[model samples]
Target: MVDSGVSAAYPIIKNYIESLGRSLNDLENILLTHSHPDHIGCAAKLKEKSGCQIWAHSPERRMIEETDLQFSVRPVPGFHTLVGGSVSIDQELFNNQEIYLEENLMMRVMHTPGHSAGSVSFRLSKDDALFTGDAILLPGEMPIYEQVDEYLLSLRKIDEVGAKILLSAWDEPKSGAEIPSILRASKNYIEQIDSAINTTCQNGKSDNPIDFCKQVLERLKLPVPLANPLLVKTFQAHLD
Candidate 1:
């Protein structure tokens, strides 16, 4: 990861990979799900060292190139400013497409946008393992998605995939009924936030955004930390 913060600059897994007698140059390709810094932070350096081909969705093409990066406070109504970074993707992937990496390794590309306009997920059909970018979040916590409707749709699509193992870049991997259950909880939380926003807005209480968000959590009997700015954005998207 690039130096966004203290922990952000360091590549935690780089040495470990190198120790396995796998040089950076040994990697065949780099698959990117989105342009978030935490995900794309070490990309440039890694690609430079390894010369691995980078593949990503078309919409995030400009972000990785470090061109026209925009940060907006009111990305949507009632939501806090979302800090975003830009990177240009070297290659573009499509929805419901399968890409063969090697004789036995094939990754199915699925465009499950929600965290961003061009978010994606990759699946190894044979292993039933899904790399769900940031579309599916951790338990008791919400991952920020710019589009609420798209996020819900993506969640449903995951069910259709019937992945046995759900792997997230930011959180622990999920198995058994964990992934499906977390998806359900995420949807439920979205609905709860929507309801809270409606009630708060109906009472003309949208002026105090922070208070409104806090109140919404209190009313829903949910943890404030769990229903953070990310969850708040989901609520804001519904209202929009």
Candidate 2:
């Protein structure tokens, strides 16, 4: 399994797996893309039930195992409700690392950090499928990334990898021409936001970060409510 939603999602995930003639115990590993609450919410519950080893990037290991520290650093609304509990990582993954899953089947890991410091994308050799977990941002949604440049570079790396199949957590499974289109769109979205920030600055720059994000969000015609603290980091990325 890629990621377990929240603890409440365990039953839903179990039902889905059972529909395919498998149960939670049949699961072997959970590959975490990042350490976000929504992504790793039910990891601990799933692991407890299945005794499956959790694999994630090294940077995310601390957060995945220490829920309180995560809350203190990246606190979110309803964070406690979203997370099941902390779980230990059996394996810490890194860029260019390859995992042999089965006979003649292997998976490659790419350290595509941006959305978070430890975000990663996995590519399976069986069908040339790439699973990107929040490393690539989508349009029409709140842009939540730590570094603008890292995000863009990760997108470029994903593009260069050139997988025919693109599986993302945010969107439906995409293949063929849709892959490039989505990559381009995600990169363009960053450019658009950067432009909005530059335009806002040209108009008038604010000393406060939240105020500055509000101005940029307004320039982008986004919801005023979108100008929150999480986005403030992304907004600050432009200035930095």
Worst 10 residues of 2 by lDDT: 224-233
Give per-model TM-scores: 0.80, 0.96
**Cα deviation of 54, candidate 1, in Å:** 1.3
> In candidate 2, what are the lDDT values of residues 1-240, reduced to their tens digit?
787887778889989999999988899999999999988999999999999999999999999999999999877778999998999999999899998888798999999988998899999999899999998888867889998888999999999999989999889999999988999999999999999988888988898988988888888788987687788888888879
lDDT of each: 0.68, 0.90
Candidate 1 regions exceeding 4 Å error are 1-10, 71-87, 208-233
Candidate 1 residue pairs in clash (backbone atoms < 3 Å): 1-41, 1-42, 2-41, 63-86, 63-87, 64-87, 64-88, 65-87, 65-88, 73-81
Per residue, candidate 1 scores C-alpha lDDT tens digits across 175-208 of 9888778889878877766777688778777555
State in Å the error of residue 191, model 2.
Answer: 0.6
